[model samples]
Target: MLSNGHAHWTGDDPKQVYAICVASLAPVVVDHPQSLVVGKGDPATLLCAAQGNPHPAITWLRDGTPVSTSQDDPHSHRMLLPDGSLFILATRMNKKESDAGTYTCLASNTHGSARSTSATITIATLHSQFVVVPVNVSVTSGQHAEMSCVPPRGNPPPTLSWLRNGHTITPNNRVLVRQDGTLIISEVLQTDEGEYVCVATNPAGIRRSAPAILDVIVAPFWVKAPRDVAGVVGGRAELKCRVGGEPPPTVTWRRAGGQVPVGRARVVKGRGLLLEPLTPQDAGVYLCTAANTAATITANATITVLSPPRMVDMPGDVEVEEGQRLFLRCTVEGLPPPLVYWAKEGSQAVLPAGITTTEQVYLSHSEVAKAGAVGGTKAQYEVATAGRSDSGHYVCGGINSAGGVMARVTVHVRPTLPLPPPIIAVPPTNQTLPVGVAATLRCLVESAAGVGVGHQPAVRVSWTHNGHPLTNSPRHHIRADGTLTIKG
Candidate 1:
């Protein structure tokens, strides 16, 4: 083609034609000038030029696929240059590992076709680093334990998941995953103790770490009476021990000297020991033990007994008022139970208060008070009257299997008071008066001597006639005991 708008050809001669034929017979050659550069998910282009007769047409193939620019679509396009160069818009498909392969630029003309060496464009896939998250784990009953998941290395960042006992443990109140990729188990129960795994996955591959096992141990507790005890004659005492372990515990009892058990003693077992009817011979060291495998623990209990109190005898001679209530009590303290009794003093083989009698016997002041008795610890007597019959001495006695004792009290009652003498009236006389009614004044007394108030006359009377004194000497009337007197 020429600018003349018409086909213009020269050198039609044999030599000229021969030269043109030779040149047309030569094969087309294509060359790519620039190396393609592109990032993931971006476009790139490879330049290719071809020289040949009739202006060689150029075509491009990527990964064996033909490149056609005639469509005018961004995803697939091409441009034919005046110099027979080929330009194609290689839109980046999803960047992926599979997008790497050979790309060839093919140029062809009427003479022949030629291809440029492959300009391979590799699209790298987005990748993340891999990390192995380490789990920091511990377990206890009703407590929280922490675990972690991490990868070796990654750019897009890997996802972390935790597993326990081969099962995926979800994030919850009981199980939690921290921002730092740590797994946490809240309220770690006995069942929570187990093996755990950490798994990390990415576009490249998936990885898992070694399983971690956690064992939880629980401590034991005390549950029984003391194991040891000691006691002497006439003393108070008790026995105790302890039993402790996980899943509770069981308790049992045994003799220290390995002797067969006998009566007068009772035993209870189950995290503790029980004793009944303790006595002087029963006093000694005792042992209590508890065991449990779940808690992997055991414990022991020890008890000691001491001496008994000495016994004291009751006193003699106890006095009380006629109608007053009375009571007598015996005092004793010891490891073993003690018996008590009461009786009258100076009585033949005295009865034990209620012994051989139907009424209940009182051993202490409280017991006596409950019996409607008017006395406390000491005996009391009610005052009926002041009479010789109301005075006497009484006694309270106490007796027990260990010993006997007694106490004494005295009581007194007094008599009531009597009336006083009568008043006297007299008439004055020149001289001494004759017998009775011969102008004489006198007083009559009825009280006994030492029987009036303060042992003195409660009433007195005086005689007067016209405010004049009577005869100095007059026969005097007096009652027996001299407590009463009269003028005649």
Candidate 2:
């Protein structure tokens, strides 16, 4: 204070307060806003402050647009507090990748507005995504095989490779990976079948593509041919083998030295040989052939056929009338048709020589196949008018180089029924009655079975008075029931 004269100032004086008070200045930055780093949907803030004669107003702008206080908008929201500070309520980077940009805070008043430097915010989409899906592929052998893998580049690009049996495959002359992430195998083979997987990698993360299956069709091949087979006489024999290939090979059975239908050999199903009623002569090598358009394979196996005469048909007990003809038959199957002989069980005499017959009880005329004709023979014994003396047990013996069989036959003679005598079942009875009445006499008789030179013979009835046969006159009436009615 400069007084007119040098006067001393006292407390609580009104004239002393009338001193000088001055206020005049533009806005001055107290704290400049700093850059910010945030993720999508995360809270962010930019600090800004300015000291001015009239307090400065705080404003926030992103890409030169004023930010709204409402967070529901599609942009970043910032609220300016009374203390000249900018507060980002919420971020707008949640929608798309375009939200990643610079953000700035401005402080303004009656003076000029000043904004902070750009805040380079990076909102990374955190996950890895696939664009191209691999697919399954099939190719024939000797053809090229390709397993494609095309995935869109992501935050971190992915790597592609081929895997077989869960292991990464190494590229050789015939197999290699193309530059565009395609697995290529030239001249595909059966061994080149597997799944190809593509893996994507980037700064964000790693991802894998769906597995692509590669299938290669191969030709047919046989692992084994027919093997040796052995069978008993009159027994069945079969030969088998193993086969391996694509589109399985067809197998056929053939004899090693001779054609099929030789002796008693035949093809069973499609894979083996069926030899029935085998003899020692049937012991030889056989071949099983497996073939396809691509390749053919053959294998040999030996067959041992044992010989033993086996009875295929035997006569059961024969029954005939006393004067009826009888024939007993027996059949046997052997490697070679065996000699069939007939004999009586207890008689010391040998059976007479008879004609050789091909008729078998079990084998009808049409049922004799080539194998049956070669391995079987039949015999029969005929009795002309069988009688009581001819009823006896007969034995049939079939002998072959391998073995022999015996069959017994029992013959029976049917007896005739004895004739029965004729008798009267009911005799005639006399009846007495009063005058002017009718009298009836009844007579019944029984005829014996198989008698009287005819079947079911009926007895003749006669009515006689005083030992005379009665006639059917006007006074006497005869009934069909052998009753005579006499009226007096």
Candidate 3:
């Protein structure tokens, strides 16, 4: 009998018949094959798993074509494992066969058939030689160094690394590797010189590039340096400097902060710098430079030129009034600044005036006053008040280690004289005047002696009658010489 779409047996005849009922289900993939990149002559495997009511059978397809299994072809390099996986004995790429393509797995049973996600199989390969390789390099110590290389081509791109002298190199603070497979070293030292090789690694294998060499050179250094020299004008001076280096350094000379005198200064091959006929302008700092391919070095020396004392400014003759201020200037120039002194001519006594090494003094009418020196180059002699005793030839002398120089200046002081009252040498004599009769009065005047004519005061005489002044009219007449006449 059939009940609810299920079969049920109720009678048994001779022998019993049994029926087994099971649920029907469609195939479902549990595990899918993964993509793979296998090197040449290397084994590889791809997995596929499924579950269904009828226990689905597994198979693989390559580019829509069923793959031949080991059971189907005894000599086949591909095998179907019992766990529903595909295994390749040895991957290859040749005219006869190539195991490089897209692959998929199919599981099927009586209920239904199902397909898995597609997967690609690629044959891995790597070139034997590098595309770009490092070459020999030469550099100076404390300089930057660089080496670059491009890895070989492969199915999966190869990674890059570096080796030095057959030992692996690890990047540090001063050494680094760029993303483009370049090695960089900052401030390279002598120890960094070695054989360098680029290493390329991939699934196929590891490939090494040709060896490259690195050479480091030493910098120039001073073996002997120059020293300060003292020279005199119209004399010769020499400064020596010696240097050593790996490549033989070249030496040169120059003046610091100024140009060397072209005809007076030159560089001597074996002895060093030579300066002839030295002048005041040539006294300064000089430099000697030694240079090489690696580095440059310099040595310095100072030249001190001595010269005799000379007067740059001298006082001139002057005439001043008595009781007036007087000033005299004298300036001297020399290497070691000279001391200036003032003295009067024909006098053994030197006035404590002018610039001294420590102080300066000014000569007053009666005494000497001390003061500070002025500007180290100029000297001054000052007199607060001029007197007749100060009128004489004054000498200014400058003395230094080199020599001495002197100059003379004359000064005259006029006396301040007092004017005497007008003297009545001849006064008007007693005279008698009468009406209708002419009377004459005479008056004489004289000015003090030694008074200049242009500076004399005006003198005038007047006549008075009973303390009253007289006028020049018809009754009284006055002459140009102070003679008065009266007419009635």
Candidate 4:
């Protein structure tokens, strides 16, 4: 036989509970509280303490588990000596997880176990970031360019885009998108440079990286070489034009004043418009025009060619020994080839009989050879075995092809010979004598009359004292002894 049990129990004796609680109860307190603030890489401390009737034993636990001391693990935690307060020694904690938890302190003794409130332990990752951008980037007028966008960090990585004047950039044949969120542009024209923005996006939020300015640096076009040109009267010069740009700059040369013909100009490739054998007609400002990719540029330069060259050193009359070579040097300077003609005084230069003349030519020795020689330009001429008859004035006249005078020089030569000195006689023969003392000196021309000094007059007699010229006085006169005397 089975019987179901259903019974009603009465409350325990209230007096019996009061006697059990009185046997096991202790007061709890915190003497030194723990709170800390530290940098990401630095260490921190959490102090939890209490005082009781009986000395209490303290223990530290993180997230309800005991902290272990392991040097190998970077996220490990531990406590060393001085147990009452917990020491969270030197360590790194991941901010995302594993490091975010509560730490509790439990103090136990004979009175009973009294647990303190829990505290949190967090490991913050370091935050250090910056940005970079390009200042000035230039390309040719009709070339290509690329823009870039970069960021320090992002959760799902950043998506890069370009904005021009606050508007999104769409790709075309001229625009290209890169994996690193950079923009590649083809045929970057001069107008492309200005203000632009780099946009970076992620699920967290859309962040614009920085502002980048595009500067389409274009090379100069139709550029003239020199700023100014100066020349003398009746001379000629030229101006140069060089260009820079894409699609190859096409150069066209023009004169400033009017459409003057490019006369006597020899054009050489690359160097510039060359004007040889220049004249006054070639003086003026010149314009150079250049075109590239439907764009045009112009540059101007002034040029002035100088007139007939003035003789820095003039040619004049001169005398030389009869047997010596007579040099008739005449310097005539002028721009272009000046016609140089040599002639004698009072008559046109006539070649000596049996001596033939080379074709009339202009000579420029140091620099390039002149254009001459009847058929072509030859720059040399010479005459040899000169005689006394050859003594006369010679002329070098420079004339332009326009028959205008450029420069002229005249030279005159006289033949002579060195003379042997005249004989001399002296009454006294003693060698040394003081200056200003009376002395007799004599000279005679019995044998060497025709001999002269420096091929001039006669042997000269001079009196000098201390390297100074001394004049003849009544006391100091030429004596019959041919000696100069001073009466001292």
Task: Output the number of the TM-score-best candidate.
Answer: 3
In order, what lDDT does every prediction score? 0.48, 0.66, 0.79, 0.54
Poorest lDDT segment (10 consecutive residues) of candidate 4: 371-380
TM-score of 3: 0.41
Preferred candidate (lDDT higher): 1 or 3: 3
lDDT of 4 by residue, 1-488 (tens): 11233233345755433211123335364744354434344566667676665667777677888655443345566553354666655545555434335767777778877777777655433212314443345576568787765644654465667777578888888887788667788998654655667776654345664566665444443323545666554344555666655556677777775764655654456536666665555666777677766577676777655554333233556554444555444444445545444455578654342333323334444221232212112222234445566565555444553343322333334455444555554333444668756565444433354444333554555666679876777676764334666675
By TM-score rank, best first, the candidates go: 3, 2, 4, 1
Prediction 4 global C-alpha lDDT: 0.54
Can you write out model 2's per-residue Cα lDDT over 126-206, one digit (the tens) per residue? Answer: 344456667878788899887776765643244566566568789899988887878788998756765667765443444
Clashes of each: 72, 6, 0, 23
- Give all TM-scores, in the order shown: 0.23, 0.26, 0.41, 0.25
Residue 400 in candidate 2, Cα distance off native in Å: 0.5
Predicted structure with the largest lDDT when compared to the true one = 3
State the RMSD for candidate 1: 40.3
RMSD of each: 40.3, 33.7, 36.1, 29.5
lDDT of 2 at 394: 86
